[model samples]
Target: MRRKILGIALILLAGLCLCLSLNQADKYRQAEKTYDDILEKYTKEKKVSKKKQDFVVDWKKLWKTNKDVVGWIKMDSGADYPILHGDSNEEYLHTDLYGDYNINGSIFVNADNSRDWSDPNTIIYGHRMNNGSMFGSNKKYMEKDYLKKHPDFSIYRPDGCYVYKIFNVMVVEDGTYPYTYQFPDKKSYIEYLSKVKQYSYYDSGITVPDARQIVTLSTCTYINHVKKRLVIQGYIRQIREYKGMVQKRKINILEDNAFSKTEMEDTNDKEID
Candidate 1:
């Protein structure tokens, strides 16, 4: 009789674990759908030339949804999401873009760094989810070949769009080097850059001279359960002014023709369907 009771309890425990796993999976699916909807609503790609294209985000619409929306980040390796700036670093760790609670949190900038992108180094954080959401794909940087193929990513702000070239990919203990926000002098900042490149898994051959603005993408890694973080660092390569007006219609521009005189004159003009 005791043996039968023990068997029944074991089966019940397994059923409970299965139910919890299924519930968590459903939550992730819903979270993914929400992000996909946001991307479709507020972002569109514009053909610059016959061979080139660029994407634009409706910064005005994003801000309207949540004033905390600061910028958007995109990478070819399946990382595209709106960035949020919360009151503290911990605010968005478990909060989604719509301020909802989920294991998959929104990408957020370091609270101590300047949101204007004027700081010497700005650090961005995201969760390394199991289903390759958020910064999960960032782990590919651990392989040098992957980094070579995908060395660049873009960030869009209200003022302009900025491109950053990845220079270093390193794994380190939390609260260690390269997590710093402020540097008292240029020399110290340069030294920090040197250490970043020095400790990288492989040299990316990118430079960060003159302390140009740099951004760090950080995500958790469970290599040995020692609280290691995978950090991908990059420096700004280009900046293009954002001049289009936000409207319901899509904003399309030709690179060869450039912005027309009328468009330049009326920066606030809405797009006509």
Candidate 2:
């Protein structure tokens, strides 16, 4: 009887382990559902708002649901994720956009960067899940072919849409000092770009002159150690007015080839969050 009882206990433990594994898998599904719901609601509201002037997202409604939401991120390769901003990088590191505690935390910007997307280097973070959600596709940037094929992604703000071209992609140690927003002078900013290009996986042959905005997408990668990270940086190539809808629309910008040169170009800069 003692042996039989021990065998039964072992079987029950196995069942419990299986259930826990299933629960973890379900978390990714839940994250997907949450994002879909928000997108659906945004679509509906966007349609309704077209009749009014100043076509922009219903920030009032979005804030009511989650004050952390700052803007939307969309990739040419079809990675569309909502960008959330919290008091600190840690706040949304483990929390979803809806305040739910999930391992697949919402895509978030570092607290060091401005919430308005005004910073010269706006770095965004997301988990690198095995299931290829969030920034999982970030690793593809390492391939020169992939970079050439899908060279651009865009950030949609309430005021307008900004298109960025992938200029450099790197796999660097976590907390790399060169990736921070602490650059004081224009010379330092140019030097930072040089370091990133020097360490990039591919030369990319793309450069960001001073005065142009940049965005960096970062994710975890287990390359010899868990602390290694994949970083993809891009410079703003174009900007268009939001046009009161989420679909692709175009507008004129102040200049073409804004970042084509190696020197600072004039910009009618404005603040955003």
Candidate 3:
């Protein structure tokens, strides 16, 4: 009787573990579904041109539900995702664009930074999801060949596109100087850049000048016993006006001059590249 009772207890334990595993798997599935729904809506509303190879954002559709979405980030080919900026940096760490709870959070920017890209240094945070959803592919940068093939990524804004050339990739402890937003002077900023460049695993041959904006992509790393972060730093290299194949109305000089200063300013909200 004792042996039989013990065997039954073991079966119950196994069943409990299976149930927990299934619950975790369901969470991932729900997260994927949420992303798919957003993508479907966006692709349907936006126009696509094969010749130009551009995927423009449909601001009208996106702003209806969530106004926090500021821009989009596309890494190489398949890793394109909409970037979100919440009032608090920790808000989206567990919540999706639709306000659903999931382990895979939205790609978020630090609340302290400006959403208009005015800050000299902007930091974006994402989780390294096991299912290759958020920043899982960011690990590929550690491999030299992978970095070579994917040298740069583009950020799309309503006004234009900003291209950033990857210069440094390193894994350091959390709360380090790289993640800090405090730079008192140009000399301090340059010194911090030098430190990051020195510790870079590979010399990417990309330099960071004082005038250009800098962006840092950060993710959690678990290789070391203590908590660490995988940081990829890049500086803006170029800014190009977004063009499309479809040309609607051609404005003559007279028509352009007819608009007042306020009207023109409202049309094109100036943003720092």
Q: What TM-score, over all chains together, does every model reach?
A: 0.86, 0.79, 0.82
Query: In model 1, what lDDT does residue 154 have?
Result: 82
Of the pair 1 and 3, which is ahead by TM-score?
A: 1
Most TM-score-accurate candidate: 1
- Candidate 3 per-residue lDDT, tens place, 136-224, comes to 77888988788889978877776666778788898887767778654665566666778777667678777776435578888876775
Arranged by TM-score, best first: 1, 3, 2
What stretches of model 3 exceed 4 Å from their correct place?
A: 44-50, 224-226, 244-273
What tens-digit string does per-residue lDDT give for candidate 1 at 1-273? 999999999999999999999999999998899889989999998887799677888878888889998899998778999999888999999898778887788999998877666567789999998889899888988998998888888888876677788888889877787788677666677778877776787777778754656889999997766768999998876665555634232221212223111233213322211
lDDT (Cα atoms) of all candidates against the true structure: 0.79, 0.73, 0.73
Badly placed stretches (over 4 Å) of model 1 are 243-273
Q: Where does candidate 2 stray beyond 4 Å?
A: 1-10, 44-57, 244-273
Candidate 3, RMSD to the unseen true structure: 7.4
Alpha carbon lDDT of residue 202, candidate 3?
79
